[model samples]
Target: MQAKHQLATPAKVLESYRSPLNGARLQQEKVENLALSEQIDQFIYAYLQFNSKYQNATADGKIPHPTKAKLLSQQRNKLDTELETLCSRSSSIFDQKERGKTLVMAVDEYLLTFLQLSFVGQRSPNTLEKMIGRKKRLLEFLTYKFNIIDLSLDKLQYQFIDQYYTFLLVQKNVMENTARNRCNV
Candidate 1:
């Protein structure tokens, strides 16, 4: 199924279109197709084919809705991040030579992707559970505290680390030592 993007009026478009940078980044790594959903693969293919479509479409200087604009920005950032990862990885499941291989890959490669991963399943259920939990907390801290919906790991600063630490200690009621330990984890 195709993802539905809303149509906007000319008045809702931006003046002087420009491509935006990704809000988050992933480390360099090649991945198997089994690790990626076909929807994401298709989205990447389609987005690549029309990299400038968003710029062209936003001709005026406004957005039809704030939420729609936010969503668009998120999607654009995700595309940038994945493309950057593919570039840095030097290979892809889509690469002919990579058709059949057992490569050592980090779980972060897929976890950090814009796509959602279920909290259940995985080789070690506890690891996956903790990952999902920490991710949720980090996202909540960024969004609720900083009003930052699109988290740019590349732009993460000490302020974020501090805020997260405080959040752990105060909001989550984790001991200071335990919060530090969790951060270490």
Candidate 2:
């Protein structure tokens, strides 16, 4: 009886060890989605700001104007569709069994495109790496502070970035120049 009980205990332990339980947050996918959403929001903000200024200038007839309004409208529509797609991709974050490779790839492509469009030219490798690192830190901080399991665009704010920088200074003991470099990087 004692020998049987000992063998059964090991078997039970093995069974529990192999139990299929996966409730932990998918942090990588969530962070990636959040970053992609941030990129989209930043691009839209840039586009709208420029479009508004361009429209105002055209209305004032400051120069020999072309049909820039049509171009802006087309870009807005495209951004709307992309935003919808981002929402759809974010929805997948809740589906525990679903793999997000396609969603990730799409976001990656859009992010690269957004970077190219925003820069309009080549960037130094250091600058590009710094931007990526800052984004990574921001996502990590948000995840820690907010228990943000899903990377939704609505969670991000300009104020969050400021708070995150402050967090690095006070909590991480980062110096002013180091914090500024990390934030801007």
Candidate 3:
């Protein structure tokens, strides 16, 4: 009786965890993917440090430093290969939803890309997060109001953007500067 009761309790807990509309797991997966990308960046940085050291030694008349050069080259190759693998893995995680002949990405995918780019550019964490959050809100508005399925720059016309700004004004009651800042993201 005790074992059966314990099993039932777990089943009940799981029942609450699997909401059809809950995207927590999907978001968590995206965060994990972004963390992996950050790891790749660190590896690349290490490779760069090795390369810098090798370059400095070569500049100082130390020609053919075989061991250090070989180590740097190997590290760089490994980082490059790892980056490729991570990119492939990330792409595989995205679902292809056809929206008017364009592939629309999920919010998590787009946000993850934004985060990766920011990190690659060496942006501060606060700045990156702020920019990403702004872009996210804009994407949400486009998705909800205008049925905008894709976030292609070519797809964003002045008229649509104007309407979005108006939405921020009328619906969200945000300031003009805030709206402009969000669009800038």
Give the top-scoring candidate (TM-score): 3
By the TM-score metric, which is better: model 2 or model 3?
A: 3
lDDT of model number 2: 0.56
Question: TM-scores of the models, in the given order?
Answer: 0.39, 0.34, 0.39
Clashing pairs in 1: 12-62, 13-60, 13-61, 14-60, 15-60, 23-152
Count of residue pairs whose backbone atoms collide, per candidate? 6, 2, 0
Candidate 1 wrong stretches, greater than 4 Å: 1-14, 17-123
The most accurate candidate by lDDT is 3
lDDT of 3 at 11: 71
User: Which ranges in model 2 have alpha carbons more than 4 Å from their true place?
Assistant: 1-111, 114-121, 149-151, 155-159, 180-185
Residue 83 of model 2: what lDDT?
Answer: 56
lDDT per residue for candidate 2 within 1-185, as digits (tens), equals 24544655767777757764442444555566557566555654554465455557567566524666666666667766665666466445434446444423344444555554543435433344445555556556756777653444444567766887888898778899988877653
lDDT of 1: 0.49
Kindly report which residue stretches of model 3 are placed more than 4 angstroms away from their true locations once superposed.
1-85, 89-114, 117-121, 151-155
